[model samples]
Target chain A: AQRVTQPEKLLSVFKGAPVELKCNYSYSGSPELFWYVQYSRQRLQLLLRHISRESIKGFTADLNKGETSFHLKKPFAQEEDSAMYYCALKGGTSGSRLTFGEGTQLTVNP
Target chain B: EPEVTQTPSHQVTQMGQEVILRCVPISNHLYFYWYRQILGQKVEFLVSFYNNEISEKSEIFDDQFSVERPDGSNFTLKIRSTKLEDSAMYFCASSVGQGGGYGYTFGSGTRLTVV
Candidate 1:
């Protein structure tokens, strides 16, 4: 079975400080990882995907196969960056559904 | 941008009553899915739909649950008998390609509260 674990349930950082939300997964095959963000009163949206290797809103996550980790990181946290972040994994199969982590509620304090 | 839309932002119902959650997937998208998140719990997959039939469903999706794409764009999830444990935020998602790897557009979600 595919599973995702986000260690931190809540994290807080001062503005301009670095933030890292840890995520680990247990999957047999090569899995695609993604970071989804949900702002207050807003719908969940994709922040970044491992396959794309692109950063969104100053956030980036690297997929480490050896460690089975896909940690979301940002150089500097902003007040507006406060939101709920979820790590999701998708298997190689066509009809594979996403297995999501428990999610991290990040608060960036100004 | 194209997106998925869900109706009834919030619903409060009595236990054992039936409830139907509606969604309007992107017009060009072919795959539809339903997922829910209980309070403080991880998001879980309920079912997936393709070609007007269920393609995959999780153990949480029992006989009491059913899905249908009645027309061209509307997809609905019907829960036969609502339980107190069924209270959660239900999300409807759609993707253009085969799996979640292609990225999915999720609706704002419908918060169901069973009393």
Candidate 2:
């Protein structure tokens, strides 16, 4: 079974401090990882996909094949960044479905 | 930006009552999916539809649950008998294909409360 694990259920960071949300996945092969964020009352939106290797809203995640991890990081957290962050894995041969982790509630304090 | 729209943002029903959650995926999307999340829990995939048929479903998707794309654009999920444990936020998602690059776009979700 393919599964995603987010060790931290909640994280608190100061407005200007660096933020890191740890995510680890269990897979038999190379996996396509993604970071999705949900604001207080918004839909779960795609923050970034590992394939693109791009940053979104100052957050970037690197896919580590050996470690089977993709951690979301931000250099300077913002108040608006306070949201529920989910780490997902796209597995199976077709890779259509996404298996999500428990999610980390990031709170950026002023 | 194109968006996946869901109806009845919140619903409350009694146990054993039937409930239907509606959604309208993006116009050009070819694949549709239903997912639910219990309060304080991770999102769980229920089923995926493509070409007007179910392509995949999870163990949680039992006989009581059914999905239909009745009018080509409108997708619906029906629960034969609602249970108290059924209270959760149900999200509808769509995608172009079964590929990781084209990640699914999710709707705002319908929060269902079965008492």
Candidate 3:
């Protein structure tokens, strides 16, 4: 079965502190991994995809196949970073449907 | 920017009542999907629609659930008989899906409350 796991349900960080949200996946074949973010009263939007290897809003996530992980990282957390983060997987043996993790609620303190 | 829009930002209905959630996908998107997130739970995939037909669905999308693109741009998900467990925030998503690695655009989502 295809599954995405985000062990931490909530992560609290202070401004200027580094933030790292862990995400892991289980799938028989290679799957495209993504990080999505939802800010207060905002729609869910894609943050970054592993294949793109590009950073968005100062956030980056690298897909580690051997570890089956795609942990999102940011050098500095800002008050604006407070939101819900979800790790999602799509395509592969699982097909085109997306499978999402339990998501981590990120709270950046002022 | 073009966005996927869901109507009736929130809905309240009694259990066993049939309800329909509506969505207008990005104009150029070819793939559409429905997902629900119950409070305090993981977001779960319900179904995917393409070419005016269901291309894929998860176990959660059983007989009670159905998706239709009744018109050119609007996509709809219908629950024949909603249960208490059906109360959730339903998100509608659309993807250009021309090739691999394309991301989706999600709607603001409709929060359904089953009484």
Clashing pairs in 1: none
User: Of the true interface contacts, what fraction does each candidate have?
Assistant: 0.62, 0.66, 0.79
Candidate 3, A1-110: lDDT as tens digits: 88999999999999999999999999878889999999987889999999889989899999999999999999999999999999999857655788899999999999
Stretches of candidate 2 above 4 Å error?
Answer: none
Which whole-number lDDT from 0 to 100 does residue A108 have in model 3?
Answer: 98
Going through the candidates in order, their DockQ values are: 0.66, 0.72, 0.76
Candidate maximizing lDDT? 2
Sort by DockQ, top down from the best: 3, 2, 1
Please provide, for model 1 over A1-110, each residue's C-alpha lDDT reduced to its tens digit, 9 standing for 90 to 100. Answer: 88999999999999999999999999898899999999997888989999989999999999999999999999999999999999999888625588999999999999
How high is the lDDT of residue B18 in model 1?
Answer: 99
Summed backbone clashes in each candidate are 0, 0, 0
- B1-115 in candidate 3: lDDT tens per residue? 9999999899999999999999999999999999999998988999988898888899999999999999898999999999999999999999998247889899999999999
Q: Any runs in candidate 3 off by more than 4 Å, and if so which?
A: none
Q: Rate the local accuracy (lDDT) of all candidates.
A: 0.93, 0.94, 0.93
